[model samples]
Target: MIRFEGIHKSYPVHGREVVALHPLDLTIQAGEVFGIVGHSGAGKSTLLRLINGLETPSGGTLTVDGQALGTLDGDGLRRLRRRVGMIFQHFNLLSARTVLDNIAFPLRLAGVSKAQARARAQDLLVRVGLEAHRDKYPAQLSGGQKQRVGVARALATEPKILLCDEATSALDPQTTASVLQLLDGINRELGLTIVLITHEMDVVRRVCDRVAVLDAGHLVESGPVAEVFLHPQHPTTRRFVAESEAIDEGALQEDIAHVAGRLLRLTFTGEDTWQPLLGRVARETGIDYTILAGRIDRIKRLPYGQLTLAVTGAQSDEALRRFAQAGVHVEELSR
Candidate 1:
């Protein structure tokens, strides 16, 4: 578990001070996968670094699993880091070491005997499905393989917390999916609290339980991933969600400019998504419907639907009322 109270960070630039992170208050529950998303220079990396004491906060305090980060001394910080492992976007492995040795490196640094380290590394290799590549060097393995080694190494310590800094950003889509699956498995099996930083909302949708959005070092939004993804409130959060769905609200409005009737955006979640709400409402009200833009999909394990429609006929208002009665979220785009 981690908690941030009025935590802020800044750096001196010439005679002036530049803030990288505004005072932020956040909580990351134990055994939950929490994600931080923002654009470049948004201080996402800075926030991640602060968790591990890599960057000292300029003000306020950070409490990680009951340890106050600001109170830790050099040795205390080092000990804390050993219990909080981190993986990088760029696989930072020793090129001279083989995959087996690369994974064993952290264990060895932690004072494990070479034999014990190698044995632990061997187990991690199989866990990550990279046992067959253990004898290969960093250069000899594929991008995915190298990241697996990085993941294996990060898990070598069996830390209570795992920090993923764009862990899948460098991989292709397929590879990214596979790596994300691996992270999810680790979270489920080990109950490791994961804090990952990424610009991709898709990553958050697939793996994170909760997410926080940042803009210019300011915390814009934070909540359960489904709530934030489904009904984004902040401008930055809305932009991220819209971009992830590849639907521009302005463009959608323009496209439906000539369409008749009230334009409504209906959102359905869980079993509400599966019910024949649309057909039932249409038939009951004799409202003719024209589908515009929409999608039926799952967010994490929960099914959801978002439909933009043109509803007409004399009973159109009644159709809208029926949609709400069926537990559908309706937004009047045009009426």
Candidate 2:
């Protein structure tokens, strides 16, 4: 429901124009959780702002729900923005207002009657599991609680799209997981199309259906999360995956080189049990195999499995061919 075509943004610094986003072309489908990941200067945040009209592009087009952003005037932009909600790294709540009042503030600004706004806020408090904390002030609540208030406030107007700019960056790991789970529930229940921008790859892996990797203000890669994780094409994408898997590249390379037989990295997904394939390879090829480092996890409720194995003797190639026939991806590692 959102599209950017050849978008570019530049700012003048010390009389030199610095490009923040470079000719970005992207599409975010309706009801999908899309993630943008990059380092600090990669312009991920700027890209989000462009969608909400907070930052106008220097060139190219941005459209949401088929309306070109470039054509919107102040009133049009304001009306368009009402349908888009945003939450920031900081909770950005009004400290003086209680949790209930903080959430009602947005609705009230939209000309909703005080009683109606309070009713809506109360409902949201319950939805976000903050019913008991409605009377608490920002200082009286924890970081996660404060963010919940922010989330409730953002949803007060029932926006179709939510832009999360490092929304969980300030919280601890446990709290982050809780907040991410809440977001996931919101997306599933409300069909809210979410755009999450963060440096954390785990966040994308956990909640995002599709992800885009940006570097030096340019789009490096974009695709389904599982596909990207399994077969990363860009160097930056590989680094992100490696970091998430905690792979010791230097040590892995050394080990692969020392192996006396063929080394292969095998990847499997959904319903394709590794045990059967391993059994078949061993029984058919007579190649001794040793399992190295790898992992298995669930992605979108589907089994995702990876294994690194060493196969001895000339039978290694035959075994790998069998694995391929069995629908397993085998990537040969350099010796």
Candidate 3:
């Protein structure tokens, strides 16, 4: 587990102290895929770097797996790094080395013999499905293949925590999905605690169990992915979700301006998403509804559906009550 108690960071820029992170408290539970999401310069990278002692906090305490970071000496920090592996957005492979050699580099640094390091590298190459590219150099491989090699190299140290610093931002959408699937598989199989930082909410929706939203160095919001994604409370978070879903709230409101009925936004999750409750309720209560906008998608492993509807008839209030009773989240929207 990783715990941050009023942790904050600052840097000396142009002869003055500049705050990069505000004092905040957060906890990332063990074996869960946690995401730190924000726009550029929002301190996402700063927070991730603090977990492995790459950046020391200016205030408060940071503990990883019960070990305090501030007390660690040079050797202790080295030991901590051995247990925390990091992959970069740009594949930071050794230019002159083969994929096999690159993966074995970390082990060699840790005093493992050449034969033993290569042997471990061989196992990682197979795990990342890069066995065929083992002898190839970074320049000779495709972007996805290079990242696979990066994953293998980061795993070479057998770290308990994997830090992905925008690991998929450099890839195409198809390749991004492929790499995310690989990360998800690794998490499930090895129970590794993965913390990834990205600007994309779609990435969080696909893999993160929980997420923290950062804006202007402040920790604005944090919660389970399903909860935060579906119902955002902060402006920064809402903007990210809107961008991810390609939603134009102003346009949507304008589109519904002329519609005549009570506006409602209904949210359904899990098995409720599969239920035909809308039609059944309409029939029973004689309420008519027109879907103004709707979306059905999966957040991590849970399937969810959200719809904006123009509901009418004298039974509208009863229909809303029935929806709430059936475990559906009903929010009234205004024009």
Candidate 4:
């Protein structure tokens, strides 16, 4: 488990200290995919660096798997880092090394014999589906293939925690999905704790079990992905969600300005998301409904749908109640 107790960070810039992160408390349970999201310079990279002792906290304490980061010495920090692996946004492969050598570098550094290191590297190479390119150099591979090598190298040490510093931001959308799938599979199969930082909520929705939203060096919001994505509490989080869903709230409101009846945003989850709940409710309540906008998506493994609708007739309230009874979350937007 990882825990932060009033953690904060600052940097010295030409005779003055500049705060990079505000004090915040957060805990990530073991074997879960935790995501930290923010735009550029929101201290996300700083926070992730603190986990592996690459950056020191200016105040407070950070504990990873029971080791206090602030108290660790050079050797102690090295040992702690061995238990935590990291993947960079750019596939930081050694230009001079083959894929297999890149994967074996850490083991070699740890004094493993050349034969043992290469054998372990071979296993990781196959695990990441890069055995065919094990002898190839980074320059010879595509962007996605280079990242696969990075992932394999990070896992070669059998670390308990994996830190991904915007690991997919540099890849195309299709490649991003494939890398995310690989990360998800690794988390489930090896029970490794994965913490990734990204600016995209869609990335979090696809793989993160829980997420924290950072804005201008502050932790603006944090929760389970389903909760944060469906019902954002903070403005920063809501904007992120809107961007992820490609929603223009003002435009949507303008489009519905002249529409009559009650405006409601209905949220459905689990089996309810797949069921024809809206049609059935309209039929049962004898109300007319028009869907203004809607989307069906998944958060991690849970399916969900959100619909904005205008409902009319005397039984509209009854329809709302029926929706609630059917395990749907009903938010009355306007009436």
Q: TM-scores, in order shown?
A: 0.97, 0.96, 0.98, 0.98
Tens-digit lDDT string for candidate 1 (251-302)? 7877798689888889999999988889988988999988989998877778
In model 1, where do residues sit more than 4 Å from their true spots?
A: none
| Residue 262 lDDT (model 4) | 91
Model 3 over residues 65-184: C-alpha lDDT tens digits?
A: 889999999999999999999999999999999999999999999999999999999999999998988898899998999999999899999999999999999999999999999999
Name the top lDDT candidate.
3
TM-score result, candidate 4: 0.98
C-alpha lDDT of all candidate models, in order: 0.93, 0.91, 0.95, 0.93
Model 1 residue 237 CA deviation (Å) reads 0.9
Between candidates 1 and 4, name the one with more favorable TM-score.
4
Tens-digit per-residue lDDT, 75-149, candidate 2: 999988889999989989898999999999988998999999999999999999999998989999999999999
How far residue 135's Cα lies from its native spot in candidate 1, in Å, is 0.8
Pairs that collide in candidate 1 are: none
Compute the lDDT for candidate 2: 0.91
Which prediction has more favorable TM-score, 2 or 3?
A: 3
Q: Candidate 3 versus the native: TM-score?
A: 0.98
Candidate 4 residues 1-335, lDDT tens each?
89999999999899998889999999999999999999999999999999999998888889999989888899999999999999998888899999999999999999999999999999998888988998999999999999999999999889999999999999999999999999999999999999999999999999999999999899999989999999999999999999999999888888798688999999999998889888887788899978888899899899999999988999998888888888899999853
